[model samples]
Target chain A: MSPARLFQGGLVVVAAALAVYPFFGTGYGVRALLQLFMWIALAGSWNLISGLTGYVSFGHVAFFGAGAYTAAILITNAGWSWPLACAAAGVAACGLALLIGYPCLRLKGPYFAIAMLGLNEVLRALVSYFEGLTGGGSGLSLPTLQASVPIYYVMGLCAAAVTALTYVIITSRFGLRLMTIREDEVAAEAMGIDTARHKLYAFLLSAVGPGIVGGLAARDQGYIEPISVFPLATTITMIVMVLFGGKGTVWGPVLGAVILFVSQEVVWARFPYVHQLLFGAIIVAVVLLMPRGVLGILQIKYRLPRTV
Target chain B: MNVVITPAMIAQVVISGLLSGTLYAMVALGLALIFGVMRVINIAHGPMLMLGAYVTFFLYSAFGVNPYLTLPASMAVLFVLGMLLERTLVFRVVDAPELSSLLLTFGISIALVNLAQLAFTSDLRAVEFLTGSFVIGPVAVSKPRIVAFAFAAIITAAAFLFLRNTKLGKAIRATSQSRDVAMVCGINVGRIHLITFGFAAALAAAGGTLIAVIVAIQPEMGQIWTFKSFLVIVLGGAGNYPGALVGGMLLGLIEQLASLFLTTQLSEAVAYVLLVLVLLIRPTGILGGRST
Candidate 1:
């Protein structure tokens, strides 16, 4: 087999192992693996828009929060099931992306980032203000469900599906257009790539994974709150993970999420208080030093295939 | 929500809003200055203010120093911190893509806020040096707010005067207009960038010190202030100095008036909503001629 085929086979083997390992693993192991999958999905989704298009969203947590709330409300108030509520959550998140993205995409670079930051605050405030629906800052609780196993399986699938989607997109002409836009948007537009439409598609696609993941995670936890669901730290962590793994690449975000999440778990277990501080320091060092990320270095130094 | 708004009530809200607006302008001054001169958004702007507030809080609580007297201390501390950050981190990314600087500053902010949390324990601290509200005709004003407003006005005036009259200020202005041309004209652009960052930080420190007198200060408080400052700069226009002052006041007034009809939560959200709307409607801001 070619190296690409070998790599693809390796991924399938890993996925198969992950899908079955929970059956033989401890509850704690399953729980941890579930969270790892969640982060991979979130990071992968973020990479779709930010990594590929260079539009760093400082407030992507808003979509996650929106999705969580939507799913929680549907399950609690409307008597919807977990799977259906999560699907509706994805749809709701897409609608929000459309509303916020149209206006926000007009602003380029840092302005877009800052506006998204503002959007997160706006959504948080709105969620809190409408105390009737979201339970305000006190948060909302879902009906107790013994659905951890199901959530784990779905999250694992999401992680795998999002990675597969990224790989497909990276090899497609549409992905080329996105990379072009990232390089020089004006040049991309001049080349007759519908930058706006392509960007919107990417933005909408990016919103779905987080939406579904948020719903799954919320159901797993059995509780949801504005602060818990929409923390700035969540956005920063996803961004750092993508940057760490290798942004704009198929496997980069997945690698980043896995390594960072495990390290974060270890750090949290050992030094909970200083982990955030260390995380911040790491972000600073990353930007200053290896901004191209681990994969970027590997690709340049060892001539690794970009697709893998 | 059904409370009637009489003229006196309106007067009180407006007067209080304007008082708070001065402090808003004070916080925004440094951000406007840095962006205007360097075109680099300082994401760490809020943490610098938080540091200032903490400095003032410690001085007042530990040494029994008057809160007003601690302003210079906070400003000086922030000034050095700003210079060091700019020289070490910001200087490397000054000419890089705008995203690099923003991310760098964001990292700096995270580190600073977390460092503060480790040191200060996230306790909310305030200096109630001047208390009680005095009535003036129909409206009443808090003494701390009046003092804060006065200091804000004085500092803003001084900043305006310095930018208008000093040779160094002229160099800074020239650099902001066109860095290459300014460099050709014998202005040290590197030094100006350093000074501008420090100067902006010092301004934020002053704003924070004044803020400590009026409200509770905590490590995480800087994020909201940073957002407010960004809104002010965007509303006033990027790279427009005087516009920042106006934008700050406008945001303050809008927030205060919004509270009359909306819940406190919605009112807080109003600032962000306004930020998005302003960004979409007028990216250049009212007085801003520089393209964002």
Candidate 2:
């Protein structure tokens, strides 16, 4: 078999092992699995828009928070089931992407990023203000289920699906259009690509994974707050992870997310207080020393173009 | 929500907002200048201000120096720090793609905030001021607010003049206009960036000195102030110095007015909503704030 086939086989093996790990694994192992899976999902989603399209989204967590909030409200107030609430929340996040993305994506480069940053702040403030619904700053608690086993698998599945979707999107014609747009929006427009529509499509696609995973994670965690769900650190983490992994490539974000997440978990476990400083230092060093990330060292063909 | 807004109440609110807005504009000048010239969205802008505030706070509490007296010292310290950051970190990615710089500055911000947290322990600190509020016509203004506003106005005017009159200021402007053109004209663009970033940091410290008098200071306050500074510049026009001036006041008035009828949180969201609306309607901003 070719290298591609060999890689595919390896993936299949890992997936099978992951599928059965809960049965034999310790509780700690299962917990770590969920955390790693969550980062992969978040990073992959970010990579779709920011890495591939060159539009750095600083407010992607707004969608995650939106999904989490939606599901939380529905499950708690309306007594909806987890599956129905999560699905609806996923739909809500997509709708939000379309609404915010269409107008915001019209902007180019730094403008788009800063605008999105502002959008996240606005969402957090709104969440805090609407005390009755989002439980204000005190936050809402989901009825704790004794089993987080389902959440772990659901997150794993979502991460896998998102990775697969990224591959599909990047290899397709739509992906090329996005790449072209990223290179130069005006040139892409002149070349007959509907830059706006392609960007919007990328934005919408990216929003879904985070939305779904957010719902699952919220249900599993059993309590959610605006501060926890909509952390500015969340947006920064996703960006750094995808960038660290090799943003445009299929395996890059997943690889980056897992490595960074594990490293962070370890570092935080030992040093604890220094994690933020170290994370910040890591980002600064990466931007200064190696903009291409680990995949760059591997001589990957799908590295992001170095166009500011 | 049903708070009746008499004209007197509006006057008082606007007066205080305008006072704070002046100091905000001072802080924003450094931000607008750095981003306008360097394309570096200094995620560390707020933390820089925090540093300035802390610097002044310690100087005031440890010694008997007035807060205003600490402004120049804060500026000097911050300027050196700014110069160091530019030469070391910012200069590397100054010419790279936008993504790298955005994330890099953000990292600097996180590092600085955490450093502050580690050093200062996330406790809220404020400069103690025993000055009393004085009534002016129908509105009352605090003594510190007036003093802060006076400093803000003076610094702003001085910066405006420096940019127009000084040779180095011209070099900075020339570089902001086009780095290549400035280099071609025998101006050291890199050196100008060093100076500009330093000047920007000093201005941030100056603003911090005044802000320390008016508001409570904390480590996490950096992100919101940085974003708010961005909002001000965006509203006024990003590269326009005068735009920062107008935008700061505009933001303050909008927030105060909104709070008159809406919840405090709702009023805060108004800026973000306006930001989106502005981007949709006029990405260049109302003042046509292009880099040139």
Q: Would you estimate the TM-scores of all the predictions?
A: 0.97, 0.95
> Which pairs clash in model 1?
none
What fnat does each of the candidate structures reach? Answer: 0.57, 0.80
- Where does the lowest 10-residue lDDT sum fall in candidate 1 chain A? A103-112
Residue-level lDDT of model 1, residues A146-238, one tens digit each, is 998889999998998889899898899999999998888999999999888898899999999999988888889999888899998898899
Interface RMSD of each: 1.4, 1.3
Q: State candidate 2's DockQ.
A: 0.75
Candidate 1 lDDT score at position A271: 81
lDDT of 2 by residue, A112-152 (tens): 77777777778888989889998999999998676578888
- DockQ score of each predicted structure, in the order shown: 0.66, 0.75
Determine which window of 10 residues in candidate 1 chain B has minimal summed lDDT: B283-292
Off by over 4 Å in 1: B1-3
Give the per-residue lDDT digits (tens) of candidate 1, residues B136-255: 898889889899999999998898889888998888888888999999999999999999999999999998899898889989888888888988888888877888888988987888
The list of candidate 2 runs beyond 4 A from truth reads: A300-308, B289-292
Tell me the docking grade of candidate 1: medium
Model 2 C-alpha RMSD to native: 2.5
